[model samples]
Target: MAISKKISVLLNLADLLAKNKPEILRKNELDMNSFADMDESMKDRLKVDENKVDGMIRSLREVAEQDDPEGKILYDFTREDGLHIVNRTVPFGTILIIYESRPDVTIEAAATAFKAGNRILLKGGKESFNTNTYLTELWQRALSENGFDTHFVEYLNLSRDETQKLIKENTHNVDIIIPRGGDNLINFVTENSSVPVIVSGRGNNFMYVDDDCDTEMAIRLILNGKKRISVCNALDKVLINKNLPELKEKVSDFVSELHSKGIDVWGDKKAASIYSEIKETNDKMVLFEEFMAPKIYFSLVENMNDAIEMINRYSGGHSAVIVTNDAEKADTFMQKVDCAAVYHNASTRFTDGGQFGVGGEIAISTQKLHFRGPLGAQELVTNKWFVYGKGHVRE
Candidate 1:
């Protein structure tokens, strides 16, 4: 299909989705009801309400309005030898995205890929089967109505064994595989898939509070980061400067705010001394853990160097925040921290595609290869080289 036609189809799909909100909600409820044994965080990701439906519609429209990613000339030049060369963006041909829960990904991810002129294959978890199936039907309908092949967007509802077979055999010629889920799923796809994989969705994000930081603002940022425990960008660990004036008061205030929000605080020995209610944790492995619950790990750091080292060692390279008033220290932290998104005095919760103004994302890639942070429509395309040369013989 032509690029403009694809955008028109997406716009139509967005309107169709908005008008059929009741049907989508009904299908979502079936998926929600079937996952009774799932954890609260996973369940939160699975649920799709009116707000989520609206978000999906908005994302489709936003992506449709954006410039087409494919065939955009990135670089054009003529060599000294009179050879003209041009580099342009192109689709990856076939993209397979395997994710768990989050029904909105069905719309956003597919829209991004289709808008970029790529065929998308969605493999959603069984828990969201009903919703994913319904959404895929809508996509097919949109394509059919727009005089496009329904195969442009395909949904795979395969069992565990079947998934393994597909990944191992590469029967569909998937050019790239993106896994948007926890570590287990990402690791499974990376290890089993024959295609190139992009790992995403793990976020053991950390926040460091420097001695010169605004304590009140730090508390607010922490609260914001912890407000949504189900999201990957939610804060998981905190490191506070031990030399901060009134360190005890700061810790007390932070712990109190978290307590008010019904979140559990786990702290190291130094932090535990300030807040008696804080549970003590001695295991070093917990630092590497991504807590997708209302639980955060706290510790004490001597200085900025210590905080940077700790984050680089333990963070999932997702997002990190440093709450400091000193520009030099904040700049140093931002430069040294090995994360996809680094923040100074801001909440890590802003690490989202919509927040970044990319409509929506297929995933927040933790890997540093093809792309990092939000994988938006513009980031979905690969580059191609077009060279022009006359028939000339080389010496």
Candidate 2:
């Protein structure tokens, strides 16, 4: 399909969603009511309301406004034998995105893949079947109205066994698969998929407080990172330098702030000695845990090197932050830490596609391959090499 037609369809779909807000919300309500056994975190991700609808509309508009990602020449050259060669971006043919709750993906992922000229097949969890079905219907209507094929975007409501069979069998000739959810889902897709898979949506992020850090600013950063616990980029572990001046007082104030916010804090012996209320645990496994709730794990580090080592060893390679006034130390941390997004004296909460000014995202990729960090529309495409030759044969 033409890029203009694609953009028009997206804009029209945004308008349709905005106009049919009530109907959409009613369908979402039915889904929400039916899933009474879900945990609070899952519900938070599953529920769809006016604000989320607004976000979906905004994402569609932004994606439509961006330039077409396909057919852009990345490299052009000629050989001595008069053969022309060029490398340009192209769609992946078909992309399969398997995700759990978070109906927003139904719009963002589909819009991104479609705008890039790829067929998208969304396999969402059962908890969001109603909402996803309704959204897919709207997409079909938009495509048909714009004189485009409805096959551009499709939704698959499959059970666990069916999903596994689809992945293992590759019945649809999927070019790539993106799995966005907890570790279990990610592992299942990674182990079972016959196609190339992009691993995303796992966040065991960390933050370190340096010896010369601004204690007050550190507190603010910590609070911001913990504000939303259901997201992948939320902070899970914190490492504090034990040699900092007034360490006990700072730990006490930090603990108090976390407690006031009803966050459960677990600390090492050094931090536990300062804050008696903090539950003490010496388990190293906590360092690798991704707490998608109001919980945090704390430990004391000897110095900058120790902090960096710990962060690199335990982080999910999603995001890591270092709060320090020393520019040299911050630079070192930002460079040495192996993660998709690294921050210096800033909150890890800014690790988002929209926040990074890339429109919306399909997922926050944690693996290093074609792309890492947020998978924006532009990142959804791969390149193809084109060669032109007339009567030229290999010698």
Candidate 3:
């Protein structure tokens, strides 16, 4: 397919979605009405409103406006045998995305893949079947209007067993698999898929407040990190340097602010001793858990080394942050932390495709194989080698 056609499809789809906002809302309502027995956070993800629709539209338009990623030459050379060689970007052929909730994935992710000249196979959770199918219809309509095959984007509404079989067997001949959800969904894909899987969406992210850090900035960052509990970038843990000046006073101020916001604060022994409002815990497992709720964890570390070690061991490899005024300390933390996006004197909440200026992302790839960080349209492609020889024979 021509690149122009791909861009047209995305822009047209955005217009279609914009004109049919009511329909999208109605479909979302249908899904929400039938859905039952889910946590508030899950419900928030499943539900789509005017703003999310606007966001989807903006993402489509942004993607359409970007340069085509396909066929960009990486290298060019002439061999000694007079053979011409070139390497250019190429799509992954087909991608299978298995995700939970968040029907916007049907729009944003598919637009990116299709823009890069890849067929998309989306398998959203059953809870979002209505919205997913409706959005996919828009994609098909856009493709058809542009004289392209509707199969460029496809939706798979399969049973749990069927999804499992497809992942394990590669029934659709997909080149890459991206799973967007909590650990369970990501784990299932990584452990069972026949093809390479990009692990994403888990965020037991941590922040370290150094002794020399700006106290007010640290507190502000912690609050902002918890601003949205349903996102993968939400803060889960905070490790304060034990040498922080007036540690008790600063921690108390932090706890008081969090309480005013209705967020639950959990702490380890040292942390709880500093703030009476913190609910202390000894369960080591909480450190490994991604609390997609109005909750956060606090622990005190003896030094920068201890803080870095703790973050490396317990974080979800999604993102980590260090709040410090010392440039050297910040640099060391950013380098030593093993997360995909490390922040120095910044909030972990910025670990997003849009924030990182990728238009939008298929996923924030935590694994480092093909690509890392935001997997945008450009990142979604592999490379191909092209050679031209004029009847050259090997000597």
Candidate 4:
């Protein structure tokens, strides 16, 4: 099919989604009870149709217009033989994404794969089967309408066992497999799959508010990061300096104030002094991390060195926030923190696809290679060199 026709089909899918997003959100909200039974294994919900699928296509189309991320020559140099050598961008052939209960994955993955000019196959979580099915159907329809093989962007329809088969036995067909979800889900895919896997590192995200931080700003950021605390990027641990005279009082007041509003808070010895209900434990829950919803824990530090030490001890390199007016402190934390996404004063929630302005993204990759932070359009692509040289033969 012509590139223009393919582009048209994608654009139409976007328009349909923009017009119908309100309805989709409304429908999901109205049926919230049915969608609320949470499972870590689930990829995303299954309720997508033409309208839902369209939005994803639109975001990809928007990013594609920016510039061809691939195909641009990165370097050119002369060899000892006076021959020209060049390096450029190219696709990674076919990419495979294995994930759970987030319908947004469908659009983000599809759009990005399309933009990169690489074929893709999605193995969605079983929980979101119905939703992903419809979403895939719309994509197939779009492809058929544009006279292209839907296989270029296929959605696999196999069980967990079948998914395993594809990951292991079908390694020849799939170039790379990306597993997105929680720790266990990602772990399972990484361990069992024979194909090369890019570990989308487990989220042990953190938020730290130094003694120099603005109290009002600190409270707002904490609330935003921890309120819906079940998310991957939600603030899991909060660290505060013990040197400030009002350190205990200030943090306690802010934490208690939120606890009064149906938020659950658990804190360490220093944090417990402020809020009585905060859970106190000997072993750092930070070590064997639990992704709890509506829970906030605290750790007290003696100084900057202490704070940095604790941050290093617990942080799994997912996300961290430093709430301080001190430029040096923020800079130090940014340099030391091992996480994929590091924050200065903003909430950990800002570690999202939409906020990062990549149109949209899949999971924020905790891994370093292939992807890190938000997995958007560029993450979905791999580059190869395109050389145009005259009489470039070896001696």
Every model's TM-score? 0.97, 0.97, 0.98, 0.86
Compared with the true structure, what per-residue lDDT tens digits does model 3 show for residues 253-320?
A: 99999999989999998899988899999899999999999999999999999998998888889999
Error of 1 at 355 (Å): 0.6
What are the lDDT scores of the predictions, listed in order? 0.91, 0.90, 0.90, 0.69
RMSD of each: 1.3, 1.2, 1.0, 3.6
User: Pick by lDDT: which candidate is best?
Assistant: 1
- Lowest-sum lDDT 10-residue window in model 1: 386-395
Please give, for residues 181-268, the per-residue lDDT of candidate 4 as tens digits: 6677777777777767776666666777777878888888888876555567777677777765586578677777777766767667
Which scores higher on TM-score, 2 or 3? 3
The digit string of per-residue lDDT tens for model 1 on 298-338 reads 99999989999999999999999999989998999999999
* RMSD (CA, angstroms), candidate 2: 1.2
Candidate 2 deviant stretches above 4 angstroms: none
lDDT pick, better of 1 and 4: 1
Indicate the worst ten consecutive residues by lDDT in candidate 3: 194-203
Q: How many clashes show up per model?
A: 0, 0, 0, 16
Q: Alpha-carbon error at 115 in model 4, in Å?
A: 0.8
